[model samples]
Structure formats: C-alpha cells, structure tokens
Target: MLDIGIIGASGYTGGELMRLLLSHPQARVELATSRRLMGQKVSATHTHLKDMVDIQFENPDPHEIKDRCDVVFVAVPHGTAMNIVPKILDDKVKVIDLSADYRLKPAVFEDVYGIKHLDPRNVVYGMPELHPEIKHEGFIANPGCFPTGATLAAAPLAQASMIDSVVFDSKTGVSGAGIEPSQASHYPNMAENVQPYKLTKHRHLPEFTQELQRLDKNLTNISFTPHIIPSVRGILTTAHIFTKGTLTKYDVMDLYTEMYQDKPFVRMMDGIPSLSAVKGSNFCDIGFEVDPRNNRVVVISAIDNLVKGASGQAIQNMNIMCGLDETTGLWVPGIAP
Candidate 1:
C-alpha cells in the first residue's frame, strides 16, 4: 500500500482529497497538514469527511511529512508550494502539487506568475490524459480547474490541426475561490448571482494556452475568460473554436470520441452537459455543436471543480506514479440534487 500525505488540508481541495483517499483500496492517508487548523481533527473543519477519516490537521513541516509517506499532495496556493516543494524533494518521496508553481517553463512561469522560478526544470505538468508518459516523473504539477475543463474540450481539435483560433469562457463555482471567507464570495453577494471576475488576467490563462501550444504549435490567437457562479461546485467551460479546414460537427465529435476512447474519465455527450451532471465525480463531460454559417464549432465541458479539477486529479497522478490502477479510489458517481 502507498502511504500518502496532504499539505494544506483545511481548504476545499484538501477536504476533497481526504474524502477520496479514505476509500482508496491501496492508499492510506498518513498525514494532512493545515497551518490554519493545526492540531484540529480533520472532521472538525470538514464535516462531510467527519467519520471517513480520523486524522488531524497539522502544520506544514517537510521533515514530518517526508518520513511518514511515500508520496505527498501539496494543495497549498502558488507562492507557498515553491517554498515547501524544494525542501521535500528527497529520493524517498514523490510529489504532486495542485498549484500553479511549476506548470510552465521558467520564462512562461515568470511571465504569468511575475516571479523568477527557483526550480522550474524538475517538475512536469500532471494532466494524466494529456501527458501519460510523464506520470512516473518524480514531481508533478496538477493543472488548474479552469484549464482542466478548457484543455480537454479543445485538445482534440488542437491535435488534429483543425482549429484556427479558440476562445474559452469558463463558469465555475464560488468554492473554487477556496475555503477562505472573502467579500466577493460572501453568501449575501454570491447566493443569487453569477459574477464575472478576472476578465483577462486569470492566472490559469498561461497554463491553458501553454498546454494547447504543446500539442500544436500552430494553435495561436487563443482567448480565455472565466466567471464565478453561485453554485458550490463544478466548472462549465465553453470553447468557441474557428476551424481551419472543412470539418462537420460529426467530424469534430468523432475526433474527440477517438481521442478519449481509452481514457475513462472524459465523457462525450450528444447534447450539452450541465454542471450538476459531473459534480462530486472525477469526470470531464464534453459536448459540442457546429456553427457552419460562422465557420465555428462550440465545445462545452464540465467537471466538479474541487474533484477532477484539483484533489481528484492529484490522486489520479499519485496512482499513476505508484503504478496502481489509475481509477483506484476515484470511481464514485456524481452526487445529484
């Protein structure tokens, strides 16, 4: 069995990690750290995981985690992971970080994050379906929530050289903002509203564009926008893509179907998929329509922002890194309203 530790275990992503890992057949939760809730029982902060795990949240200390587990999932924010990851890179442990710290090349990292990377060359992007071969690498950088939905929707088109340009508009739940209480995410403002924030400067933009460019160098002129809805979970991304060649809607559908044929997590639907359909599960459901008159194709994808978008994907990477079944502990169905 692989022993797993999670850093930053008080937030939405960390709680989701605890929920999923509690049922994993071959994995055990050894330690989960949270600076805010140190020494508190895991169940105290996240009632959903109350009886599922008996572990307590601890403070972030590399020495405490390195000796207790074979792998670690860093669920902390961007700048924080950089400070902790480098210290825990001994040969005994593998790490999957669910932050934007090492998702891009050093130059691109600097451009988007506005910081010179302290160690950029050692980490690989951790979207398993997109980069399966790199799963065994020592360190992995999990993709952002918005990028996960957007990239899966447009990857097939980008890979086929069929898309000329792409515009992505993502609507996600307020929980994606994290467990912290902010004025924007306060119940009064978010309860009955759909607000569009981060118009052009969402941090996920560079990670999204960089991955698409990796698949097709000709993929240029991409635009992305993200919004926050009042819901508690899920991300719905719509990609407006201009095709380069003559391809019908059926052709585009076929491309996505074939591309994800062997992949178990991506679900291709005939009609548009709703956010509730994929909530609480690690599935990315995609559907698209053709706008022949405008020479465009519209692709829509949905995922539970906290699950597939963050902690679930981090666990998927851990399974791959450890040579276990990729779907080991993540086969639960979506929770319906």
Candidate 2:
C-alpha cells in the first residue's frame, strides 16, 4: 500500500483528496498538513468527512514528509505550492502538484500568474486521456479545472486538425473558488445570478491553448470565457468549434468515439451531458451536435470541478504513475437526482 501525504489540506481540494483516498484499496492517507490549522481535525473544515477521516492536521517538515509518504499531493494554491513542492520532492517519493505552478512552462506560468517560479522542473501535464506519457513520469502537474473540461471538449477535433477556431464558454460552481467565501461567492451576490469574470484573458486560457496546441500545432485560435454559477460542485463547458469543413453528426461522433475509446474516465454520451449526471464523480461526460449551416460543432462536457477537475484527477494520475489502472479507485457513478 502507498502512504499518501497531502500538503495544504485545509481547503476544498485537500478535503476532496482525503475523501477519495479513503476508498482507495492500495492507498492510505498518512499525512494532511495545514500551517494555519495545525493540530486541528481535518474534518473541522471539511464537515462532510467528519466521521470518515479521523486524522488531525499537522505541520510536518517537508523533508520528513518525503520519508513518511510514498506519494505526496501538493494541494496548495498558486505561488504557494512552489515553496512546499521542492522541499518534499525526491526520487523515492512521487509528487503530484494540484496547483497552477507546474502546469505551464516556467515563462508562461510567470507571465500568467505574475509570480516568479522558484522551481522550474519539467513534469508531465497529468491529463490521462490526453497524455499517455504520464504513466512514465514521477512528477505530475495536474490540469486546472476549467482547462480540464474545456480541453477535453475540443481535443478530438483538434487532434484531427479539423478545427478552424474555437470558443469555450464554461459555467462553474462556487466550490471552484475555494473554501474562502469571497464577494463573488457571497450568497446574496451569487444566488439567482451568473457572474462572468476574466472575459478575454483568464489564466486557464493558456492551459487550454497549450494542451490543444500540442495535438495540432495550427490550433491556435482558441477563446475561453468562464462564469460562476449558483451551484456548488461542477463545471459544464460548451465548446463552439468552427470546423474546417462540414461535419455530419455521425462523422463527429465517430471521431470522438475513436479518440476516447480506451479512456475510461471520459464517457461519450448519445445526448447532451449534464452536471447532475457527472456531479461528485471523476468522470467527464461529453456530447456534441453539429450545426451544419454555420459549420459549428457544439461540444458539451460535464465534470465535478473538485473531482475530475482537481483532487480525483490527481488520484487518477497517481494510479497511472504507480502502474495501477487509471480508474482503480475512481470508477464510481456520479450522484444523480
């Protein structure tokens, strides 16, 4: 069994990592660290895991952490994980960063986040369906929530070099904001309302561009806009893909089917995907419709922002890195109504 350690375990993503790891047969959470909440119970902030996780938060030395855990998940925020990751990372312990720090190239990360990267090590972009090379890497940079859904929605077409340009519009739940309640996530302001932020230049846009561009170098015309919805746990992305040529519905479906046939977590649906169908699960349910008149293929993808979008995806990467099936501990259905 692999002993797991989660650094910065006082937030939404950290709580999620603890919750999911509880059911993993080959994994055990040995450490959950939080500087501010040191010595406090993990379930104090993550009440949902009250009875499930009995461990208290502790501030452990990074070097000591490396020796205690076989796998370490850096669940800290941007600019913060960089401080912790380099200390705990070693050949014997695999590191998976659930932050924006290692996802982009050093220059790009500095440009987007406006924070200098102290440690600029090469790591696999851990989107299992897209990067099979993840299985061979010891360090993984987990994809951002918005980029995860948005990139997957357009990957098949991008890979086939059929896309002329694409616009990604995403609606995300409040949990994506984090555990801290902000003015935008405030109940009065966010309730019965949809707020769109960072319209033209969201940070995650670069990730979407980077991943898709890897498949097709010419696939550069990508636009993304994200909105905050009233709900609390999922992200649904609508990709308006302007294809190079006319594509019949059957033709579009065939391409997607062929691309994701072996990918267990990506579920291609006959109808449009819904957040309710994929909520609380580590699955990206995708569907598409071709609008022949406009030569636009609208692809929709749904995923739990905290699961497939963050922690669960981290676990998925861990499984692949450890030579286990990608779906080993995450092959459950979403919580549906």
Give the Cα error of residue 11 in candidate 2, in Å: 0.3
Model 1 Cα lDDT, one tens digit per residue, 189-241:
88888888888888888887888998999787888888888888999999999
Provide the global lDDT of candidate 1 against the true structure. 0.87
The global Cα lDDT (0 to 1) of model 2 is 0.93
Off by over 4 Å in 1: none
lDDT of 2 by residue, 217-282 (tens): 998899999999999999999999999999999889889999999999999998999999998899
Which one is best on lDDT?
Answer: 2
Q: For model 1, what is the error of residue 148's alpha carbon versus the real structure, in angstroms, after optimal superposition? A: 0.3
Q: Provide C-alpha RMSD values for all models, in order.
A: 1.3, 0.8
Candidate 1 vs. true structure, TM-score: 0.96
Off by over 4 Å in 2: none
